[model samples]
Target chain A: MVEQGGGASGAGCMGCPLRQRSEWCVLNEEETRFLSRHLKKRRYRAGETIFSAGEPSHGVYCVASGTAAIRKGNAEGNTVLLRLAYPGDTLGYRGLLLGENRRYGAEALGPSKVCFVDRAVVKLLLERNPALGQQFLRRIARDMDEAHDHLVRNATLSNRDKFIHLLRALMNRHGRTATDGGHFMELPLSRRDLASMIGARHETLSRIIGRLEEDGIARFSGRTVYVARSHWLLNDSRPPTLLD
Target chain B: MVEQGGGASGAGCMGCPLRQRSEWCVLNEEETRFLSRHLKKRRYRAGETIFSAGEPSHGVYCVASGTAAIRKGNAEGNTVLLRLAYPGDTLGYRGLLLGENRRYGAEALGPSKVCFVDRAVVKLLLERNPALGQQFLRRIARDMDEAHDHLVRNATLSNRDKFIHLLRALMNRHGRTATDGGHFMELPLSRRDLASMIGARHETLSRIIGRLEEDGIARFSGRTVYVARSHWLLNDSRPPTLLD
Candidate 1:
């Protein structure tokens, strides 16, 4: 369920942490002021639906904190995890711009904060600011490029290579250095969710994890994964071969 | 090899068929005239590289006729066909927008004609025309949506179902109705290219095609696929099961 937070009056976009991110659009003073006046903050608990498939989007959301999963269900009644949204990422703008219903559902992967801006305001801002529109184009283009990469990986990579790639991504996004010169991070998603992200069966994912443990490359305790050799995880071009 | 064609002097954006496409951007007379002044046409033979991966894009390409394959090489050195660009589709805008090297290579799937516009001209037109920029945003958004759909299908669909989905797509794009109420089309891609597009091994794809022929669902004759039941191919939610 959406927990309605205070409007932009409490904490506005003027000094938001997202502005520090390179991907965030640069807004002129007048545009920023106008945007701040129209923004509303919303919070969601883990597993809460931020938006659903087929829903009409009247506004776009900015991920102010935490992560969200973008997913869709296929004809077979199985859900596929398309990608994860991180801080500073905008959602629903695609549907809004295309004037179509949402193509996928977005859910809070954990406790997350998102800021919403209405359709009219977003349109007005883009019309008045070419820089913002160009920035959006660049961001969407980068997204398309990543999507192409994901398609290639899905088509060509072995399951073990795919898992390693996913781990490398997770470490880059969320892992931290530990006292043992390793990388440590609480898994942002459940093992089941991870399985869906990597396009592996639950049993296959479990077997891969077991093999990783036996190889002493990574250790998983509860929902946390510890990479003993962080550099190897990050830089190794050749993934360790698995007997599975 | 790129065969340089006559400049925009021969024929221009004015009355160009691409302008009729709903996906193409709406341009004012001034904008169209400005664009035409800068466009240069290039022709490519089948299997010719339109643009190589890692090349810096100084501008964008507009597909005037025929088809092109967008592809990228994976870590294992196998090329993955990312997607196909048909007539009226714009290419390289993503790389141009990000000011980055091309993330993938594009090649002519058949004899094709393409129009090129330089970066400065494109930037000038976009700056002077907000409608053009907005239309690009919409197009990129649609592309992103399709990419997400591709990701989901790759994850969940069985190989047979995937082949059926591909056939349905091809039928929609290039199929012709036969007198007997069937759909027939020359395959835009060779069997090897189709295998790469669908992420199947060459042998696996051959087996699938053989099965498709035996089931009386689709018939492959050299470089063409004829579907006896066009409506079934398009609307059948339940894919025929195959004994692999």
Candidate 2:
């Protein structure tokens, strides 16, 4: 049942949400029709395994709805949530593009819909339209640039500061909210998941969140967190000493 | 000085390195002839600033010889040396590609040679052969991939481990040599410069290097660092901890 696919391919391209600005979304209708015929839509339930690290391969999948998480673990079983992918993003594609069989595991964060495009299909598309391939290349390039910059910042900054900064970044990307305290934007992660994303233990993340609340930097009610002062979190004014 | 460029633009259908791989490198023989007609090489002394971050646009410089240290700094003046660029690598092309007037500074780590291709010329090349544009896109993609991975590793690892892992990575990429009690790699960077490259303070870097030596991890003499046990350094052997 695991390897049973929907069909030979060609399903999710036309009327796809990603068709708006994604590389697959061609400027011309003729190109779009050509590509649509090569895409296929697939669905998965929440908590379903999309792909495992070190597994064979299924080519790349373009997300249409819901969310997915990329997670990697060390030999000791310590896990790190690499990224929380959303709509319009491509998942498990980096490996195919890089020509690697596998590197990490990907799972649906919730009931998600994805479009599967096989390697052969991709090659055919490239052969048919190099310009579209060029657009795909650019999209990956942008993702790479942002990912690298984010890593440097994470490595250099302290746990709490990084947590706050990540919150700020996600807030900007998703949506911003103006609250009486300052700006409170909801995070799309569990406490443990947030901890793993920032390379801290679950307890450490909880402690830091508690400390932030006590310091009036942020507040939390159940799973929801409210930022009391966004400016203080964003600016390094009188920065706190960081000891690792 | 910003707009001062050739009235003619550079296009890809001419003789460009990108022509070798795909249409992206489409450099026709005639355009190649014209470049040879006007091409000139420039040299710089070691420690020279070729172009500082925020400098106005001019043209892209392709590394012709020696080496160039690429770096990006934060608002706090802390820098992250992106990479040590060498011959055959293009230096400072991102701004030109992104349409940004300026960002990121380029400096020479040693006596370096470079060929400056006018921005106008590149713009021309892009127009004639969109395929050739793919080559430039590929380069950016590679850079982004490297930077992104580096950031991810740095964010997840501790400072001491990050430095050790960084040296291992460097040794692999640049090659290393074995000595009596340890291994030595041609140290491409001074302590301050390396600290900048690895995103650490100079003092912390110095202390960490000393600690690494004391724990049979490595020995530093002037610019050369001979890691006592290179294999262990490469591995995450948490049992072998360095005493403070």
- Using TM-score as the measure, which candidate wins? 1
Model 2 C-alpha lDDT per residue in residues B69-126, reported as the tens digit of each score: 8777666666777777776677666666555555667788878765667788777776
Global lDDT of each candidate: 0.79, 0.65
True contacts kept of each: 0.85, 0.29
Scored against the native two-chain complex, candidate 2 gets a DockQ of 0.29
Worst 10 residues of 2 chain A by lDDT: A1-10
Best model per lDDT: 1
Q: What is the model-wide C-alpha lDDT for candidate 2?
A: 0.65
Give me the iRMSD of candidate 1, please: 1.1
For every candidate, how close is chain A to the native chain A in TM-score? Answer: 0.91, 0.82
Which digits, one per residue and each the tens of the lDDT, describe model 1 over residues A1-244?
2333324445567667686662345787677778877777788899988899999988888888899999888767788887899989998878888888998999999999887888998888877876777777777888898898999998887677788888888888989988888989888888877888778887899999887787777899988989876444444334343331
- i-RMS of candidate 2: 3.2
Please give, for residues A56-151, the per-residue lDDT of candidate 2 as tens digits: 666777777788888776555666777877887877656665566666688887888776777887767766776766566657645654665665
lDDT for B201 in candidate 2 is 85
